[model samples]
Target chain A: MFERVLIVEDHESVSNSVKQALNDLGVDNPEHVSYCDYALSWIKKAIVTPQPYDLLITDLSFEEDQTVQQITDGVALIRAVREVQPDLKILVFTAEGRLEVIRPLIEKLGINAYVRKARRDTQELKAAFEAIANGRNYFPLQMKRSERNGHSFNFSTYDITIIRLLAEGKKQKDIPQCLQDNKITPSSLSSLEKRLNQIKDEFSFTTNEQLIAYCKDFKII
Target chain B: MFERVLIVEDHESVSNSVKQALNDLGVDNPEHVSYCDYALSWIKKAIVTPQPYDLLITDLSFEEDQTVQQITDGVALIRAVREVQPDLKILVFTAEGRLEVIRPLIEKLGINAYVRKARRDTQELKAAFEAIANGRNYFPLQMKRSERNGHSFNFSTYDITIIRLLAEGKKQKDIPQCLQDNKITPSSLSSLEKRLNQIKDEFSFTTNEQLIAYCKDFKII
Candidate 1:
């Protein structure tokens, strides 16, 4: 179980409820911050010290106050925090219910759990904590539905770069030269072809255009 | 035609090529900057002056240097520029080819044109300028193909909010009350149902879950 947790949320009521939830889940010594900047500073300091936070529970959006914040949003905060502490488990608690927004937080950003702010969000928070404590990534029911529909593919940065190039109107044969010029590794034709074919097979796509279309539709590239 | 254009690109070669392309298009006086902060400062200055730049052409990503920049990326720059000069047209010239990433810039961020930096990118740049000059939003061929596949939708902020709430685990019956609590307008159940139906019909979605799944997959929400 996570003995120490840090909650980053702007709403006072929500933050209090999260603390109560964590208390009920038997996790004590949970700290909270109202601003992303403050939270980030705390995390950075914790990183330098021996007792770093066991888990970071953060909200994606924060209400802008009069003072200008260095890190305005949770995405930037997460990226910065990840850079400092790569192994830290992150559980995002946000009112932003869009999968388009949160998918990257999970897939690309490597968040451990996501608990949406809704009617029974406290319950979900508890579940999220339990899941994270057990070293499992918790996906809400909606995200599970996305996975069932084949929208959940483990995409490497290498794969994304290749697909993005293709979408930029690069022909298959010419990709090697483009990659070589860009100094991207595995620029050989055989590797490119094999990788593209593998992606096509995974998605049941017939052509590069279709693959591009699918990627665009899903915002994959 | 735009007489004055501001180009924001970190790459020296790409910036030079873009300048040449603009010159070839018979549009002289295209100013270039390597840093987003410098580009934003120029834009801010132009806003108060009489001879404001007609169009802004920017790359999405900027290389980080030794000195920390206030406006680190092109998205932040575009947002700041849009706030100051709402009428100034924006044409994104970037190697970023992911529709998922750039679609928001077109639909939400209000960028007028996109020119992918690939083979014959200079030609595309000229075409983008021509489209913008003619008061048309230039959709790259890949983007056009996405629209053909029914990926394009005119999603209002309200619609996105509603769908996002649903994706966040809010029941249809509970949404109106939740929205009402948040002081959001059109909080009646009938309106919410009608809006959801319209969106489902637009995407041929049989259920709210499917709609959410589609939104997640396409990064629409």
Candidate 2:
């Protein structure tokens, strides 16, 4: 019954297509914000607005420097919106499929629905909207079978500590000192940097700077 | 507030302790079932009886044997229960921290709550029970940050093929031939074994056989 929808996505073409699709679904007053700040402003005004968006479809990734806070990623954006409007339904649309990466926020942030961005089918989003519209839930079906089976990743908590430090603009050589300062020296972090490099390669990046910049931009730091 | 809880956990001590903790929280009927079958039986019986258990606190690792149709290892259990009693609250007590692994179920399954197992405090189980009692959600606060930044480890279609061939007791030399036969070459599999070894070490295993055995046991194969 909720017709108004708001979308928080960085991809302009994709966002427009989704907006048009919702229009086809008879949803009017659908607003698309390309960044979290704009979406937050809309949500802040939603309390007094005559017509507040009933549904939200957001993407996890955002354009760099467009995000305000170091932690103001799309997931963070969703968390903020949840605080403002606990009753509003949200559906996440993302292409990132790492089961290990987003495991914790699924429950922690109180997301209403999730749709993996599929190139072949719009049915995933369609199904998600239908489920939430009926006051039911929608998520991937294979999660129960896969469970936590492959959810573990190579980077330990120490790696995150180092990555966060690096994102703070510390030098590559100073990383070892940083790890030592934090009292988390499993190995001399020259070795840790080596490990970090390995992680970056796994995700397909060549250098520490690129990885650090990527993490900072994504607010992983 | 509902008191009776069914615990579907594979680990013996964890299963026992969780039940004990629930009992300590003043829930008299905290039923604990280790295998998925036992858990399923209780769910089925509860459906017919109507005086069903109020909650399911499941470990994400429980898998039915190789032959059984893997309906819902962990999520399926909750789904099965929800199929019968759509309102029953479920709390996932898990070590899994991946987006793909956790996102779909939390959004789709209508899980009442979750408590990250690794961050289990001295009174964490009691806290989880109490949260459920109050009709509120309880997921760990810190889990979201680490889980988001964590690199998602996905075994590629090629990775799956290699692991499967390894599981079938094929020797190391057979991998290149196997890949060649399949019209794909993964360069040298010597490094493949090294990566597999690293994976095995992370998951706590000794040999390829041990890794294969774990796969069989965990239903990852």
Candidate 2 has a TM-score of 0.41
Q: How close is candidate 1 to the true structure, as a TM-score?
A: 0.37
For A126-162, candidate 1 gives per-residue lDDT tens digits of 8888998998999888655445555556677889888
* Local error of candidate 2 at residue B91 (angstroms): 50
List candidate 1 stretches off by more than 4 Å: A1-221, B1-5, B10-37, B46-55, B60-90, B94-114, B117-119, B127-146, B151-154, B169-174, B185-198, B201-207
lDDT of 1 at B134: 92
Q: Which ten residues in a row have the lowest lDDT in candidate 1 chain A?
A: A143-152
Candidate 1 residue B156 Cα shift, in angstroms, is 3.7
Clashing pairs in 1: none
Give the CA lDDT, 0 to 100, for residue B99 in model 1: 68
Native-referenced DockQ of model 1: 0.02
* C-alpha positional error of residue A168 in candidate 2 after TM-score superposition, expressed in Å: 11
Q: After superposition, how far is residue A118 of candidate 2 from its true place, in Å?
A: 1.4
Candidate 1 structure quality by residue, lDDT tens digits, B98-203: 6667888988889999877643466677888898989898977765543565555778889888877765556678889989988999999999999889887886
